[model samples]
Target: MHYVCLTTSDPFLSLRQVRIYREKATGQVYAIKKLKKLEMLLRGQVEHVKAERNLLAMVDNNCIDKLYCLFKDEEYLYLITEYLPGGDMMTLLIRKDTLTEDEASFYIGETVLAIKSIHKHNYIHRYIDVILII
Candidate 1:
């Protein structure tokens, strides 16, 4: 396995930033989900993170974010994933009252398909509440 030394001072992460990171070679942008404060982590949340990773690995679709890799520090777990150029759907919804019928249908269709795939694999997306922007 490949590894690199990362310091707390490294710009890759910050206190308030829930996600941060850069590609090692190509400088491609990526998001880092820091699972430090999650109660499960504090109480040994190994199962939750492992389950999430397992589920993410099984997902193969363009509409869903791709989990690239996982890392760990002494106290936290880091989930590296693809950065969506189009941000979250909730953010978009907050900025607009309603989308055109066709646009709404397309987005809903894609989301439903993605959800169906996840359920088919026996994984419930608990984080979907925060990603309801579509």
Candidate 2:
């Protein structure tokens, strides 16, 4: 539970802001997603948040990010997940503009596998943004 924040700003686009942290106990790194409770209530995303937690718990695959834990304060709900040091796909695409055929195929294959796994769990991903891919 002892973790140190590694960033002062959000690293990606989403309904919540993500901050990187490193656990002092094991020196393991993770991403902490901080979602404002007020925003969720206003957007009627309360159920979505719960569903996300449930779905994430059920998912177990290398292609999909894994959630490690969840916690909440009075203002924000936090989701702790395994950290991927490699930046998101959007950042990669922005820097490289395009990928070679092999690289593109690899990414596409991973995405397909992730999608199939999610479907198997009876959850359809509503967001397919590059930022969602790590």
Candidate 3:
């Protein structure tokens, strides 16, 4: 149930950054999100965090990130998810800047499937679109 930060580097996103962590006993690497409970409460974002955690727990989709486990200490709530070695799609596309037509098609297809999967589960993604990617 214990993990150590594997590195100081983080995979940054628009909203948050994900850090790599390794389980002390198992040596399994995972993406760990640490949220400060007091900060969340002060910002009135506690419900949003709870909702996101619940959604991650309930939804089972290939395109969706898998939540492995979650635990809390006095100051922080730690969420562990599967580690994506190559990083997130946004980072990949951003690094590339532009994609070929075929590559765009492939990514668009994947995005559509991901969105559809969420829709099938009765979840709505209001702000996601292939055209809006990157």
Candidate 4:
């Protein structure tokens, strides 16, 4: 695999930024989430990071985000997943001031199921209180 491009404007943001890469043989694209080890340790998020990875791997639902692979170097941990082009749900909510009753119900249903799946695995997503949609 080779890193083809970075999607974020600021690479210094570490975990907040993502990079796009292509598989050398298959030509398939993947999104890479890079987390700085030092930062995670300093922020006391080591267990949270590990639980995120483990719980993602356990999940096998369509609504939840997929975790394809995981690896780490001496300084950083990398999570690989399918590349989703559409922007996150927060952006959609901001773009459209309001949703129809049916539209709102659909999103609410999906979010509930996604949360249920996470809780089923005995893991509580630290950031689940705020729905990010995507």
What tens digits encode model 3's per-residue C-alpha lDDT throughout 1-134?
78798764443322334688888999988877877777787877777777677767876766666688898899888888776565556767788999899888888787888788767767775444232333
Better candidate by TM-score, 1 or 3: 3
Model 1 lDDT per residue over 56-87, tens place: 77887666667888877776777777655555
The segments of candidate 1 whose C-alpha lies over 4 angstroms from its true place after superposition are 1-17, 42-46, 129-134
Q: Considering TM-score, which of the candidate structures 2 and 3 is the better prediction for this target?
A: 2
lDDT of 1 at 50: 77
Please give the lDDT score at residue 130 for candidate 4.
Answer: 24
TM-score of each: 0.72, 0.87, 0.76, 0.80
Best candidate, lDDT-wise? Answer: 2
Q: Please say which candidate is ahead in lDDT: 1 or 4.
A: 4
Q: Write the per-residue lDDT of candidate 2 for residues 17-134, one digit (tens) a residue.
A: 9888999999998888899999899889998888788877888877566888999999999988877666667777888898999889988887888788888999886864222344
lDDT of 3 at 91: 64
Output the number of the TM-score-best candidate: 2
Backbone collision tally, model 1 = 2
Candidate 2 matches the true fold with a TM-score of 0.87
| Model 4 agreement with the true structure over 1-134: per-residue lDDT tens digits | 55566465333345545677777777788777788888998888889888878876898666655789988999899888666555555656779878899878888887788888988998878665223344
- Candidate lDDT (C-alpha), each: 0.63, 0.78, 0.70, 0.72
Worst 10 residues of 1 by lDDT: 7-16
Q: Order of candidates by TM-score, top first?
A: 2, 4, 3, 1
For model 1, which pairs clash? 89-133, 90-133
Measured on C-alpha atoms, candidate 2 has an lDDT of: 0.78
Over 4 Å off, model 3: 1-4, 8-17, 125-134
